[model samples]
Target: MNENKKTLGELLNASYSAFGYAIGFSCLVNLLMLTAPIYMLQVFDRVLPSQSSDTLVYLTIIAILAIIVYGILDIARAQVLTRVSWWIDNKLSPIALAKSLDHTLLGGSYAAQSLADITTLRQFLSSPSIYAFFDAPWIIIFLIVIFLLSFPLGIIATLGAIVLLSLAILNEKVSRKPLEQANTLHMNNQESISNSIRQAECIQAMGMMSPIVSKWLHNNEAVLAMQCTASDRSGIVLSFSKSIRLILQILILGVGAYYVINGELTSGAMLAASIIMGRALAPAEQAIGAWKQAINALQAYRRLQHYLSQPETRPPEILLPKPQGRIDVNNLLYIPAGAKKPVIQGVQFTLMPGESLGIIGPSGSGKSTLARLLVGIWPPTNGTVRLDGANIYTWNRQDIGNHVGYLPQDTLLFKGSVKENIARMDKIEDAKIISAAQFVGVHDMILHLSHGYDTDTSRYHLSGGQAQRIALARAFYGSPALVVLDEPESNLDQEGLAALELIYKNAQKSGITIIVVSQRPMLMKHCNKVLVMRDGHMERFGLYAEIIR
Candidate 1:
């Protein structure tokens, strides 16, 4: 698993050759930028003085050709960056998605931010903003050319470059904090809105929408204020830099005119020197213009680096035989990441092959947490949960996935056909889907839908009871050896309850071990053993009749 861990920095390092090509192209583009000034010099100094139309025409032709080549090279540079951006996205998106899922499963928020960061990074990579930095270093070439034209002009141009560079630095320092703050607030606001949307039915039914909207508006105002602060600061710097560049260009023209009058520089040289000075300072001004994007991209890059640096959570792939129905929990404890108290602690139990156990507990007594542990969804902080004598959390999912079934409390049905969801999103034989559906007695219910087994879950809305039945079929898919069902009967009706009993009988007949987190009497009658829990500790564990007596 470690061998598969790849970082954004490492991926960029691998693309160094592509960047090198872009830099090489930038060099040629910057060199070709001198075409206009050189052409001006030749036309004004040599062509006019010599009174030669041929010389002017030939100069024009050469300048046009140089500009064409410069345009082609510039396009090539952008193309290279675009391709590199795609390559990085292709490699890092899956890793980002996996990490995002792991982070969410571990009870963290901001899962969407990882993908958003990738978009920001990719946009900056293929944007004109990045090219500004590449073009920045070549300003020295323009300054040198200015010096060769006139020493005084060269000094002035150099000072102008230094001043613009300072403003660019100042822009970064001033606007970075507010921009970063605004970005953080924006992400929070997005998460808030997403949560509200997900619970829109509840909010509307309970008259909670007004309060939720008010709170959202309040948070959004803060985000806007921070963004305004950043923009005002950047605007000031950018505007000042633009003004300074214009003033310098005018100053150069005035100085060149004076020098030309004094015969210290020729007319062509004076004109060329002013143009070169403007070219020398253009990069710094452009950098100021795009400073905000640069800072955002830098922040995104850093976040991705940290996100990718996390240790791989997936177990290494190994060929292991299918697990029997045995489970062993040895002194297991689990404390959430930022919590002081454990959700489930000192939990120890064992179930022999094909034995069914029912977990009973109050609302906050960690029954769901224990069910999660049994299915390897959450790792224990201390001790281990072993299936077939191997730690369940460390068992390679690819090897053990087919042998286990889990129905989470939420009972989510992914967007797919009824048959596809029953098959756990795997495209498999229709016989397996039908058999799994039949095991849970949902096969007839599925056929009554608009498209029978092929109905799209996204477009068709199932009633709560119907969805639960379908989810039950999914849990019973493939005749798994171990099945953990959390609050499985919450949405069931009388018929559904009868189906649940049939499922238990079918599971027992097939020798599948069941761990159900429920307290209902109907479900309890089918369990051989019952484990009672309260306050993160086990209250009792024995045969169902023994516990009841």
Candidate 2:
């Protein structure tokens, strides 16, 4: 029940033509449903009184035809609604994902919330929450029709419905606070459970099973107590409202019966009036349910809106074409949040085209940050990263991606064949694929696989070092102008490290600019120069011997 910053009207406005058509179809279905009861009353009051057998037969045939038509319309309406929901889900998912990625790259604190909010929003979109829009409008229309048919009776019924709705709203207001508390407790309990599972091995090793289990149970009990209390409050209110509505219905029926007996109204008219009252009241009850669902949907929408509002780390821009890769950081400055001083303050460096530079530093130094800045993962607080005298940020994201290749310490491989993982399903010839794998020292491993390059990596996996090599192969697959590797030899043994050194030599030989961040002295030996960093600032830049000394 949080106040929605973006209203339902705004959402509808943002929706495409298909959404409008779906709503129109749903309304037509409701119109057909309303007609069925009216048609029934016509047959009972007018057609039957004529006492013509043929007329009765024709009326019955028409009613049956209307029923069939209504059924078909209902089916089509459901189909359209389903499709609309799917379309919204599909369109919104990518936008949500992109926003989350942008926030993460920007070092936004709410990145995790962005992911959770997107998931909840998608669920709301696909659930009964959206259908409530169709139902609520139809219910209002039904109530209006009933009011027109019988003034006094409709007024009485309307009063009863208003009372019921008011009570429901009051109940919602009273229960929402407790429901929120219960939900908070539930989330805390879930987090505790997840942490317990993730640290099961450590817990067992420390023999703290009893303490962990006791804590988990305590949290679970607290969550359960909160949930039960909330549920009881909601149930009591709903039961009371339902009872009042039932009493109102009985009173209306009794009044109608008395009027019929006193000859103030005909028997058929009384029956029709009772039927209309029920139809109108039924929609009111449905509307209450829809209102509850709307609250949840609105909450989900608000969460998504918060995610979408986060600032982008690297705004999308178009970069001018460069003939060669010449990286220059002019008075680079990076100040992480809550830090007193900027990392890499007033740092400046320039690398000519095809120059291979190595960055070496202790842990927690600015080596990785500098590498990230060079790759455009983070923008400097002050200063600029330029390629061929033009700011890299000015380039289109896709263009930067095509020109620069980055390999992080933790390489993630998707579930696919080696060929698909390496080639990325591009139309690369086998010879090129083999050459790239060979250049990265993974060619022999691929040859040994059951299907060679076609082997399903998802079924049979590679070790960490092998995976890193494959990742390296993929990064260098397109022969990007600038290749940045962070801790390339961290997981590799001596043999693998030797293989990587050869790969680096070959890359430099091919006139591709290479920048590597590593702690290993052996890797730095092959570089022409080494850049040393400490505490987010560059300390030295010189030959490997000079820096080591």
Candidate 3:
């Protein structure tokens, strides 16, 4: 990933057919554009000498038609390029999103960074500027045309181009270190600012506003200093390059004047040569800048690729048959990354169909981790988690997802209508959505809104409890075989908690296996059995009364 071993041509070969076609069309348009100067020169030098009114009129019409043709080609090329960009973006977005989602399921520090890098790569790759490779080759074509027209003039143009391009490339290299640093610092500053604003009330309550502001200001100052230095250096380099290019241009014209005096070149030819030289050199300037940005984009891409290539906890091809609403963990020893001790050493548990199990533990116990493993969010390090006697890791990811519903501590609600949030998919029936919401005690809340289920609650109108209930409704909407709830009772009031208990009871009667990780004793009271964990190890597994005793 650290090596830059491939050219843009090789990299783009991985793109789809539509992308290739679009790039090809863009190149064609650029080649066509290069011919316009040659045509103009021919008209000025040859057609004007005849000086016939009809001939001049005809030539003018031809030139106008050519301009119109060029305009059409340019428009077509732009349209094709846009389509390619959209196609590639759409294709890559899902892969990047899926990788991020998968990383979330397998939590770790590297996983977190991998998700962020995927997002950045998606954004950078989707930009239209990344596909500038198609237009770069036209610079060579322009130079060749200039050489064919006048060799000495072409040499001067090439020399100026090299100088300007070298300066641009060097400028890019010098700025990269600072630019990368500035970007990272800016992200840190933004995070600090966001944290400060989000916890402004807490800061004021604790009289810690000064400290929070100071930290945020420190991050901001670092970012600003890096940006200022990079910008100043870039400006100086650009100014110098422009000055040198202008001098080279003047020298070329002075040499061309000598050729004209020797009757070796026409004024129109010299003018055309200059125009072509500018056209030839412009893309070189663009390429220098593009190459710099591309390098940065590629670095981000390598990070993203590493994430996409990470091994999942379970492979997709492996198949675990649908369970009979039973789960078992036999002598399971769960060790998280960088932990010296297993979280759930020698933990043995089993649940029959229609039975409800409650997991209870203090903070730092492995209650949540156990629930995650049961639901196949992660694989055990030293033992097997079984579903109906089939090892859970043998189950396909989609199959496990379909049968096991997991609700984490934090409930995420998307910005949409209440119905959209509840259904989660367009194909979900309205009646099913209503029933799920009603069962979870959020139907009444929805009905009270202006549009009932159709009401948009994206403006932070819903309370934490309301959002949690909605999330629960979504989880239960499909009637999964097993449901794992982590801290589901945290934000609920007494009535809401009672409603949740009733929902679980109903689910149990329907033969669904319910596993809850909760700190509340009241919630545990309803369970048939309770598993108590301490210091990442299960201390007891028995009925609630037995465990309490």
Candidate 4:
């Protein structure tokens, strides 16, 4: 708890009124819980001894009304708890999703598990077993009434409570370690299964399914063994608690009978004492029975608290004006998410608005890193990449993305119509979509499809070259001021290459800046300047004619 920066209790306290109301309902319900034994006591002691039909009728009527009100209170409490859980879910679901995505982008664990944790907490809130925790304090309340009957009875009930409570604590201590181990084992197995499914094609081609299955089973068996250990340990305590409760309850009657024979208690008082003692011990017994679930709930709560403690990435302080495609890098450097040394070090360059630069490098020469930095996909390790005089990383990414275009080596389309993909899923414009497609020479190919622009392109059903052309069309959409294409023609054929050249001519005429990262020099013919990189540093940067010479 000292190590935790935020806690489940704090999150619950944020919804103070809802929790307060639920607790209020619990108090009311527990107060009403006293109704049953009291009603039985009155019938056995007062009404029957009085021998008046009217007295019996009146007492019975009052008891029935009290029981009805008790039922109502229980129902109301359940509804309140359910709503509180709903309010929590509605409030935290979106925030958790956004936080999870941001963390993932920064190389943190996936937050989807937090959603599952929240559901587990919601179940804990609504489960009938949960009411035991709330009712626990009322054991003293019940014991006080027992004391009013006889000192001996009060002592017996107190001892019973202590014993049951001890069993609950024992249950927790016995199961905690194994339960924690089981949870860890479960997570490892889940990750293994997810990885196997994701790489199923590779596994199939390599015929490694049998070996993977054996590894998965080994992980699963460890989890199962821990689960069995926890269950066995908790089962012993749970069974012992139930046994003690029954024995003490039955002995309460015997003790009460002994007192009754000595005129210390009445027959009615003896029966009432036994019933009240069971009522008091029932809660602890229920808790003992569910100790394993309680441990899981505790783990889930801590996981969520740790996740919530992580600071969220803030949005831009204020929206900035649109930037022209003038890029300036000063002593720029980059290191991957988890690495010891920089991948690009002390590299610097500048490109004026409307300038076209071609980036050529050997494999692992940091060309892709340079392109990503220029587009503000990531922040630099040191120094900065500025666009139009302000640091590009300081600007709002969503706002700045409006003016940037990129074609990554890997092109992925969402489950949407061709027009939507071209428009980057923003509001559709017929002219912009058609013009971009025509710019990439995919317009005729699109029209030939059955649904033309409205076709659902979930699977990239077209040929590889055709898919690359569509991706190129997307990059050219809206005539973004700066276009960065990282190996854009890797999958394009001669016709697609011609379309690429046409886009360059058209973009050059329109004065849009372009940066193309490629290994092959086929498209360098269209570049006026070239930058060469070798071993994470700039090797040469000059006019195309000079560099070629």
Which numbered prediction scores highest in lDDT against the true structure?
Answer: 1
Residue 245 alpha-carbon offset, candidate 4, angstroms: 1.9
Candidate 4, pairs of clashing residues: none
Per-residue alpha-carbon lDDT of candidate 3 for residues 308-407, written as tens digits (9 for 90 to 100): 5555545555565666678888888888777787877788888997788999889879888888788777778878888887777657766666677778
lDDT-wise, the better of 2 and 4 is 4
lDDT of each: 0.88, 0.70, 0.73, 0.82
Best by TM-score: 1
By descending TM-score, how would the candidates be arranged?
1, 4, 3, 2
Off by over 4 Å in 1: 1-9, 313-317
Clashes found in each candidate (C-alpha, N, C closer than 3 A): 0, 4, 1, 0
Model 4 agreement with the true structure over 1-549: per-residue lDDT tens digits: 321234435556776887677788888887777777777788788878888788878877887898898899888888888888777777666667767765665666546577877787778777776788878888898899899887888998999999999988988888899999998888768867987997898999999999999999999999999999999989888878878888898889888999889987888888877888888888899888777777787888788777876654533445777767888889988887879788888888888888888899899999988888887777788889887877877676667768889988777776798899999999999999999898778899899887899988974477778778888889889878889999988878888888889888877887788889999766777887898888789899888887655
Q: What TM-score does each of the candidates earn?
A: 0.95, 0.86, 0.86, 0.88
Deviation from native of the Cα of residue 82 in model 4, angstroms: 2.4
- Name the lDDT of candidate 1: 0.88
Global local distance difference test of model 4:
0.82
| C-alpha RMSD (angstroms) for model 4 | 3.7
lDDT of 2 by residue, 190-297 (tens): 766776887887999999999988998898888778767766766776677777778777766677677667866555555565665666566445545444345545
Q: If ranked by lDDT, best first, what sequence of candidates would result?
A: 1, 4, 3, 2
Weakest ten-residue segment in model 3 by summed lDDT = 1-10
